[model samples]
Target: MAASPSLANDNKSNVQRTKTSLSHLPYEVKQCIVYWVDRFQKEPHRFGSDSLLDQIAGGINHPGKTESRNNHPLLAPPSAQLTNLLNMHRFFHTTSTTNNDNKPSIRPQCNSILALCLVDRMFYDICRPLIWQTLDLEQFHLSKLRSLRTGGLTRNAEYVRKMSWRISVHELEALWPDLREELGANDEARKGQDWDESSRSTEILAILEMCTKVTSLDLDLRPTELDKQTGEFTIDETETTSKFFYPISRLTQLTSIALTTPLLANNSFTEQFLVRLIRDMSELQSFKCYGTDSVTPDLEGFSWPLPCGSPLGLHLSELTSLKELYLQQSDCFDFTWSKIEWAGNLEKLTFDGCTRNPLRTLHAFCQKFSTSLRYLKLDYLEYEKDVYTTLLEPTRDGPLSEIKSGQYRLDLPELTTLSITTELPIDLLLNFRDCKNIKSIELAMNPSISAEQIRELPCFWPKLEKLKITINTKSDLARCQITALKMTYWGKGIELEIEDEDEQYNSARFGHAYEDDGYDSYDSYHDDDSD
Candidate 1:
């Protein structure tokens, strides 16, 4: 206690001037700890890993799975609960690199927000809007439009709110070297093209007019040619429709588009620029489109005609604030769904590999969005196999038995996630046995679905809670994993998830099929499609 050396050097200079770092916290605690270290450095198994316990140990050989921590490999020292259960999963899932679609790509590793922006200037202004939100130019080049025009990244394009470009025609003739002499002086059978006054802006429309706050695009005009007999990039619809849809119809504050084209099924000038860019968006809420994987599950339905008095169903009923409509392998059954008076504010409808006659237009378009649908999916849907017992039997008659005795059973009442596939049966699950607020089911089941039709799905979804069930072989994925572990030990909290589609049908018979589930692989370009 020999204090007083000038009062202990002024209390060690007031404890080195109140030492605290992350720029002295509290800017909402340094933005919630830099938003969970930028989601633990971009989705570290959503903050806990070991590949989510090997995806809850259902990577097969079942008998209530969970045992292999790689057969006792952790020789000691790792504990901080084994380094937070290996959240950096062997340094971000085994050091990446697999691309040309064999999958495992993994690039975006922002080096923990560039080492928390070198720990200064308030973490480079909180990691500059998480590194300019998202501007994925899907392998785009022209030196990334000359580094978003003259190396400034167009003043951080208002922190781009999601984009995934891929427009083509050789990236618009390398951003208009007179765009192939203005498409051969505007006469390639001129239905539309008219950008004259010195080609009204080009470099991809000045980087999508400097991304004025994009709201989830994804564009991808799909013009890959290569295939000198199997070098790959096959589909090429002879490139024409790209005035980048006239600067993507001036964005109109897009709210989720998706597009990916193959000239919207035989291009009537890209189906009149996707019906005037979905009638100027009107704040579109999720549209998805997709189209060409060169469709096939016996390819017949592909109608688009329109233009007679074409209001395009009153411009898709003025969108009325649409909600999530996806139509992969596109041309969703030549619309006019009784002049589509909009899906009464639809909530997630999807119709993948759409071909035709789902009882002549999907049970009157799911009985006009059966009371605000909540996630319906219908995958690989090409009709006929006695069209779901001639549209749910009910003592068979014409015109779907007066909509199956009026209001045809699909009483959605705010459904809760159902995905289809086994080519619709189980008597069309009695048209969604009064959906009973279904909670996540995704079947794809085929081996003639029985174990008494999986014990009548908890007596028709009494609030079913998650069942996946993909199965296509390996002895019906071990007899549907012993009837989903006897419906989860009979207590029925459900939670089952099995997949094995015979290694996705031998990787879609070796053409290396990779549509990663959000639809399109109609059995990888169809060889008499079955599962």
Candidate 2:
């Protein structure tokens, strides 16, 4: 897209007008150049994905003192001063021209558009909006966003299309007084437990209003509680939560929204607001509610109390425009697949650490949306019962009455990609018997999967292009069987990947040590578990 002059500045004289031969390139080409230049920048390893912060219970020092904990050096917020100065004079746009320093230590992690600004005025004018397209804002510096909006930074705000906020409950609380003062909140409201929701909502609204063009938002809202005597930080039952519904509802341009932490909502207003917020986002296409283990994972069986008299009530099926849905480690009550009839347009669905959903619910899901679904990922999700055992020794199928009932047949004609990991039922895999369109399949090895079952996978997925299986270290000699299977059938060019549980679990979840032979130690028992 061509850069908008109103996005940053319209004055050509303010930018360095160097007449270089490269300046003749098109604006889109310059954006391409900026992309390649920034391709090597180190991205955040874990952007609020892990639940380490959530595990910290009880009160600790305020977030201001520990602000560096959440600060991502690569995603530093935009400098209003630098942007304003660049807009005022050409000299400010001209940066160091040294291009030979390829060393990582000397590399600049700032937006690549800044480098283009140094090239010439034409390039600067063409590439300025590229810098503001995506922003990583921390709670500590959120107060400055309002200043940037009013004081010569409004143009830059409109350029923002995506935003990721790394918020700490402590830091948000610490900065509350300042934000309250900025919004003209009273002293009583600032000190009291029941803070003025209007001022708080207005503060967020003010900030979000400035970034009128934002479409995607990733929020890491981890709440913390303070210990009065011990001076420790922990998560307590404190009711201090911010209301974001009204503020977030104003993002009419939003298409993609992701909540990486469950503590984003603190009180009734925030919870109810979230439902309304989702309902109002008419343009939303991709929605993800990611959870760290601290919140949803802990409330496995507990039902999330729904707001009274609220029609929406956290059910997202009403979002007819939604195309992709991703839920990770979130409680089943937060949003149930069976509770609402999903839009027919839904294409990609992912469930991670969200294992509480019944097998029947999943079966029904595939039956309901099988025509439109294409990509499906079920990772770290466990089945309610051991379908493998039930299939082998069947008195009653419990809820999975397959052969006796003979009514429920697995049928998804549109699915192309499927991934399942960690304690998935063998009966669930039977559903793939009818999914002929599956091109890629990922399965995690457990005691439930027999050698015969593994051999039959390729038969079921005739169009399989890629196969990835994770073998648990405890499963004896399963790796050898997988290798044999690969050599037997996969020599025809199907991509095959077999990862040990140590490698998969260590990097992905809690660290667990192991041997290269897929055991805890060299002397561990080696009885064959594969049937």
Candidate 3:
């Protein structure tokens, strides 16, 4: 054999020569090929026609990724729009969408875009942006990011649509090694001082400038310091923290936002910061706010920016383009039903770990958007006294008392999925007697809920095709009986599961109740309360 160096050179020369003719292919044609390949490799079985060539090309890039015939009939049909949304959150994992179906199409797998990159130089250039579409600020390599932004490694900063970054006061010193001077006058002063505008806020402002195209942002800025000894998250009122509203307002393309910070509900400035930031995003579609544990804001106690007006409500109402809203791990005493104007257009609504609403608000909300609302998830909910009974009341020999109260028919014809976990009342299920379109229903509770109540769900939701429930019971006989009923439902084309879950943490993690487990674990903090 010739010298090893010459052998390697020859091999590289041969590989390069093979792709010399690829340039002859039209740039648009090359892009078109890569686009469909990217979709097939990552997308679900969307209801659209695909050419034979498309499938073959996609298979070349991703060998195993293919559609299956037996996807769960209950789950939503593979939506191209929803698949794109799912890809955006894969980087943040915390708020990722999940499919309970066993079929391969519903379950999105992480197919490496690297394989496409290896095909050729042009292929790499075309497919590179998608790989960087979602950036996790913490896990991302800081050195490569600058190169990707400005340097000639192929700047693809515009591709970053969804990004999440976490900032905790406990780790402030570590994050800003050079901010010691601003932190304090001396070593003792530095250690004693809390995080302020001069420290962490400046750094965040700089970071946001780099990713201007970010549409979905999960920003968790916990100004509160957690005492290691006592294991409590506390915020010092005296210290002044910088407002992100000004910097965040610059991200005009922002549509979906998950704002997880303790300051919003606890501090007035932070709440205003959120309000101003939201007011600017006229195109915002989905909004989720994570507040401090148990510090649910009461709608009754809120001081409106306008006299006798719900400022937050009014501010939210201005978001005419808004569609989805999720409020979790916070109370909504001030977030009344009447305040929301998106009721006509809102498609999805979720309320988790929030205080119960008055009967009138709940009923009016359900009725207002009954036609438009496709998804409703209520977990770790608290209901006011007699609220359930009032909603569950059947149409009697009374006049139309409330809107659409002809015979107390609370119809949600458009509702496809319903989740009721934790303090969610079984009577709420009964209220859905007119919800003929509901295909999926999730009900999980402690052993306190009776077997008869769970059994009666099928009767109310005649159209339900999927059911997930968890009940805690010590009796083996009880478990068997429940499992038997669940199987009976399953046999009737309703994909069903009856989890005899004993773990309190699992229940708490899934948004049942937050038990004081000394320190807050990741599950307890974020509370992935999806059903």
Candidate 4:
């Protein structure tokens, strides 16, 4: 270690400095250097793959990097600005030179791609934690693990090495498997002297404990095979029961949680898991639950989790601390459902599916917590008649299944933005006609909606500070109605009332070019989209 006096000495000579190295730098300086080298300077890390190296060097490091650019001491090894830190020495060369033989890793974590796999062990140790800052647990990735030779060990290890904690847990089961083989294979630890559920459980338990570090968790619960004999669905007990539970239970710091899948079609854990998950995440700030199937009422005899007798509705009532709630594709009348009863603090909401039942129930639900909503999103939405009310209408003393109002009452006094995909009627605009606090409104029309019908929506979004409309015809906005403070077209990005002269050099268009999702349309020109 260099002496403290030597580190601070401004007049130190080469002899004095020769004794110092990366460790001798101040703590802040060391952090900056490591942040740059690991995140930016390492060319492979920037592109999230090592292919960039071969591409730049024709399967090697660029000749000029080692001979000229890298050797420059003054500005050669540059990192990102304070707010942005990236060491771009490697990345710059990859782009400056041309070599396209190598492939880049997608969603490469800083630890595995840039640190461990691409760099030497020395680099791996320093940058491990940063790579795990954010994780994405896609369901398919884990499903593949269930079929691996090492009994999900190889898949788990390889994935863990790169992602660290961002991974899916419930995918550790095959779509179809014989009950005997599945149980027998999972019982190998029983063959040993210490063979017991405890040992087998411990193996997967460790995987979950490691996943506690994940800050962003995405869970997709899709359909699995049903037991042909009993007409009951089956999941890998070890994966969902052990591997999935532990991490979810302990990951209390998660800020974003997305619960999605089409499994509710054939499976019954949709509501059960959602409740258990919400209960476990007491500090959760963001929650999104999207279902791709109709929700069926829970049967009275067989509980979802037979061993642990708990229902979804009871668990949902426990989500008192939640701030953001999003629900989609839920059948309105499903006795056991995932609906937001009290979203007093919800800041953002995106409904991917539209249901008439929920719409009827929404008036009362919205009134219950109308004071705290900020943003609302509706996609693929279409109004439906209140089946709940229609049934109750026949009997006067029947259950209060329908909402008091025919249309959903949106009393969001603090709402700032509203995004909905629907055909707006001219008279329907009266609902938000006088919303003074609303600053932004995004509405998507179906391709089939006539231009005449499109114009029928009351043009009273004038209070909007930002208005975005997607039109199939160029003439839709020819004399666009909403006179907002800031009017932005869907073809372009959410343009601000202000201008960005330097927008030409911004990172607006800097991701996979082929992913032309509407979100990235205007992003094609993002300045950061270079090598």
Best of the candidates, lDDT: 1
Candidate 4, position 504, lDDT: 23
Error of 4 at 260 (Å): 3.1
* Best first by TM-score, ranked: 3, 2, 4, 1
**Regions of model 3 farther than 4 Å from truth:** 1-109, 138-154, 169-204, 222-243, 262-271, 292-308, 329-336, 339-344, 383-409, 452-456, 472-477, 498-531
Per-candidate Cα lDDT values, in order, are 0.53, 0.52, 0.52, 0.41
The window of 10 residues in a row where model 4 has the poorest summed lDDT is 507-516
Local lDDT at 375 for model 1: 75
lDDT of candidate 2 over 226-275, digit per residue (tens): 34575333333332223443456567767777764433354212323345
TM-score of each: 0.31, 0.56, 0.61, 0.47
Model 2 lDDT on a 0 to 1 scale:
0.52
Question: What does candidate 1's lDDT look like per residue over 168-286, in tens digits?
Answer: 44333333455556556444422332332112224545766786876667655533333456433333234433446556666787766777653233431233345556566787766
Candidate 4 residue spans exceeding 4 A from truth: 1-25, 29-127, 137-209, 222-256, 262-265, 268-270, 276-279, 292-314, 332-344, 356-360, 384-411, 426-430, 447-466, 472-531
* Residues 443-470, model 3: lDDT tens digits: 7755445666666677777777777776
Q: List the residue pairs that clash in candidate 1.
A: none
Instruction: Please state the error at residue 131 of candidate 2 in Å.
Output: 3.5
Tell me the TM-score of model 3: 0.61
